[model samples]
Target: MHRDTGRDVVVPEGLLRIEDCLDATGGIALPPGVTLISLIERNIANVGDTVAYRYLDFSGPTGGHAVEMTWNALGVRMRAIGAHVQRHAARGDRVAVLAPQGLEYVAGFFAAVKAGMIAVPLFAPELPGHAERLDVALRDARPAAVLTTSAARQAVDDFLAAMSTADRPAVIVIDDIPDTAAHDFDPVNIDVDDVSHLQYTGGATRAPVGVEITHRAVGTNLLQMILSIDLLDRNTHGVSWLPLYHDMGLSMIGFPAVYGGHSTLMSPTAFVRRPSRWIEALSAGSRTGRVVTAAPNFAYEWTAARGVPADGSGIDLRNVVMIIGSEPVSIDAIRSFNAAFAPFNLPRTAFKPSYGLAEATLFVSTIAPDAEAGVVHLDRQGLTDGRATPVPADHPQAVAHVSCGHVARSQWCVIVDENGDELQDGGVGEIWLQGDNIGRGYWGRPEETETTFHGRLGRTSTSGSHAAGAEADRTWLRTGDLGFYLDGELYVTGRIADQVCVDGRCHYPQDIEATVADASPIVRRGYVAAFTVDGDARVVVVAERAAGTARVDRAAAIEAIKAAVMRHHTIAVADVRVVPAGAIPRTTSGKLARRACRADYLRGTFG
Candidate 1:
């Protein structure tokens, strides 16, 4: 073992080997013989041991310190947890990990996979604003066991207390499990097609749905992400603070491990409180020469505004490639981040605008590491008319959208009309994906799965080298996202459900929300939700008044929002309400909860 403390166990003979499934270079191909945990052992033993995973502990007495876990140690923990969990949960049963962000979360996830169980990556009950989501996910998955830490046991118990006895799962205190239990770890025969985890979607439009992600899908998507970002370098290091349960965060947890790279992590709370901690981690991780990480649009804006060191002191981002994606890629946020970090040697080409969703196992496409973010200025009315027409940046109706990059590696992307007929280059329509990384479908919803995951092209769709020679029977993922292809890049507009239509013209809510925020400082930036109420014939805008705003100004703020939307979008608002900060809801991924607000609005819950 690379960092041996003299504690070692014999290699289990039952362990499946995946070496045969891969090419000689060990770069591509994934067969069902072995799981990710199996490869972790072989990779560490074949190469020398190194720091496989690291956690930046901000809640510690020493202010902040990094806890390192070597690859060998991580393997031991996996086996220890795996063996203990198997004793509680039968093979193929759902096992939810309810631990906080740390190595405990990481080990618990891999352990479930090694035990031939379907892992439902979830959050601790203490994570505020997500309690309802946790309950819904557990009730939906109906996991046989829940793995949590000793510190979180009481809260976990309280959370489960609300459920009936039969619905409550067996709780495993992962930290209390003895390391010696790893000796009893028995690797099960798992197929590539077997369900590996349930990636619960963020309910921006509807209730949270668990996507049945298979082992094959995870492996294929991981490979696609690594190759797309040129992250195959053995020295790659990943730094992130995203919640591990989310799709992108779950993928980042192992992005470094698939190769010989190391992962540095911290709590999302820490990153939010002091964004500089993320920048510091990036600088520290840059010692490896090739560092990769990811974050949503909000994180970039926050890090730029409050994270960057004033003098550009110690951070060096010369070798960092941070993938930025969140529904609609914010072109302004990208520019702000690069400009703020430029003094620290952050290259203009370092940030990659990308597109992905849980349905596709979290990755669809991302710009190349070598290319700058692809953005285009288009006419606002043209985009609303289902056509992407370019206009001058100074044009009054000009709107900007960043490219989520071309379809990655082997995936196929096609923009099709409502009838499933392929659209031309400039046609803005629903974006569909055909790839190995796509999840099986929504868990336990066969009809919904058939509608979402089973789509056939009405006609042949061809887009530059991608989606060529499409078979008539290839199943496509109807990624409810709306976008179009321009010069080989995918420009995601907005969700199909999130679109507001009045007088036969479709408009994305984000554009109206942006104008609302700009209309007056009274409106909180990035806290506006625009939707249509009263049967899609009337436009409604609900905005969050900035913190410390006077109650007397609500009328003027509402008037400003209405006037701005009418001027910019040429739509009359049927109702405008300026609510207090945080009265508006937001998804866990930091997206405005427009649908939730609409529900409350319909219930007359907002005063």
Candidate 2:
């Protein structure tokens, strides 16, 4: 069975049967290599002089300098850095990248692969204002060397100084290494199953869970994204302000580089400082053709609400495909972006709602380019009762969820109940995935890996068990997210770990957080975390204050929030805390850390 994804690009045949699709298409594929290093070598030989990357430095001494690199130039630096790495590390060793976002980071990452070492991409310590997460990751990976540029040498030095000599790795300064050194180092023999990189789960604060991504998994995912998104031409360029350590950023850059596509890079801090920079880059790229870019939901809302020009000068977004992924897909965020920027000629189809995680090597399901996002309103009470009952727009309990489009060609998605029985359509349960894109699992944690990566569907007959041949796709990935399907499209509700159960009815924390955020003017949007305390069926919400407001009347705001939840879904709020702006903890990808917030509440940290 096939479904149309708005574009003439039809979802591949037998989309529901992922295992069979893989059996059919695995032998004949192009664009991605058997190994990432081989892909780099292929690009160097084919498009050596084409502009591969462009880094925009808004705060450089030259005042907005553009540092460009050709594929040939990058290859030379890659080999030189690889030669330097070979001096201290052997093949299959781990190498950590801690450089600031720029060309140096790119060179160092490719160099690790060229030297046949597993690359661990992490953020520079000073950029995020702490090294706690880096400390955790350093202890986990225990790399042979650390890669950084002169710009971040001091910060890296300071961080490594705290560690014992035996625990510390040699720090390699990328800029100091002369490109004139030997660029003809022998290529290490690499297999498709070799580990390419270790993508740490969250940045700098939480205990890092290194996801061991293999060369075959990454290469297969790139091909999946390219074919599913219909990236036929090499002329299409990518503009990204996301950090290099993030899976989204790394995979986005990886796809273009492997297929000889050009990309424009900028610091994430630069984008936050001036969101208009992202707009300008997109507008410029659109002139040549459709520009490709991606970010989380918050970025779209932030750029649209704060970045779009009042007079609309230097803004034309006609040919831009900005994919929204990472966190839970929000309908209000999409509407807010379209309403703010649509007046400037941005099409309604520009916002592509997407869903993915680190376990799947980043790119998962995304809306097609030609269609507007599909949205449906559901009754809140019905949702808690395990039913996706549609409600009228004016209904008191109505909630809207945007579809994450169809899964990639060879990927299968199943919504299952607690006992591992597959659910019928409209039954919300855990999301299970089966595809080549799934990673090898967490590094050095086989027990956790087996439990998460190796899951089996209920083999017994049930009301919702897949009819036949579904047993072939038995080995599935437990996504840990809760969602359902309606009319063949996937809709993610929230995380299983974050689902709040009150009065024996299941409720998503995001739903409660959204209600509180919209309940009062004082509560900050996109910064609310909803959780529960021990011995309580009532919900607790921790929210930040909006900027430029006078001291809020906390009591009045609390009453309004409590009243709103009661009116909307007949729920009670056990506690409501409104702290200073930016008080809530967030992952490096800008998602609210609900578990951390709960721990802080228990410890009275916000008090």
Candidate closest to the true structure, highest TM-score: 1
Task: Encode model 1's per-residue lDDT on 1-607: one tens digit a residue.
Answer: 2322333422333222334435665434675344455456555565436777899999875689889888777778888999988888998899999999999999899889878899999999999887988899999999999999999999999999999998889999989998999888876766778888999999999999999998778878888887788776767788899999999888887675566567889999899989999998898878657788898898999898889897837778888888998889998899899889889988888888889999999988998768998789999989988999988889999999998886776678889999988898878999888877899999989999999999887765554434684444778999999999887778999999999899888899999989998998788787888998878989988887786667546678778778988999999999988887788888887778889889888888777
Model 2 has a clash total of 1
Clashing pairs in 1: none
Those runs of model 2 whose alpha carbons end farther than 4 Å from true positions after fitting are: 1-33, 203-206, 310-312, 460-474, 535-538
Q: What is the C-alpha lDDT of each candidate?
A: 0.84, 0.79
C-alpha lDDT of residue 26 in model 2: 57
Summed over model 1, clashes come to: 0
For residues 1-607, write the lDDT of model 2, one tens digit per residue: 2322221212222111113224453532322235676666556656778888899988765557789998878888987898888887888889999998998999899899878899999978896533667888888899999999998899899989988998889999999999776444555777778899998886412466899998877877877776656665666788999999998899767866556767899998889888989988998898888788889888888887779777738678888887888547877788888888887778988878888888888777877767898889999888888888888887878888888987776677788889887888888888888776788888888998998899887743355433333347558889888888787788888787777777777687788888898888888888898877875565888989987655677899999999987777677888999988878887787877777778788899899
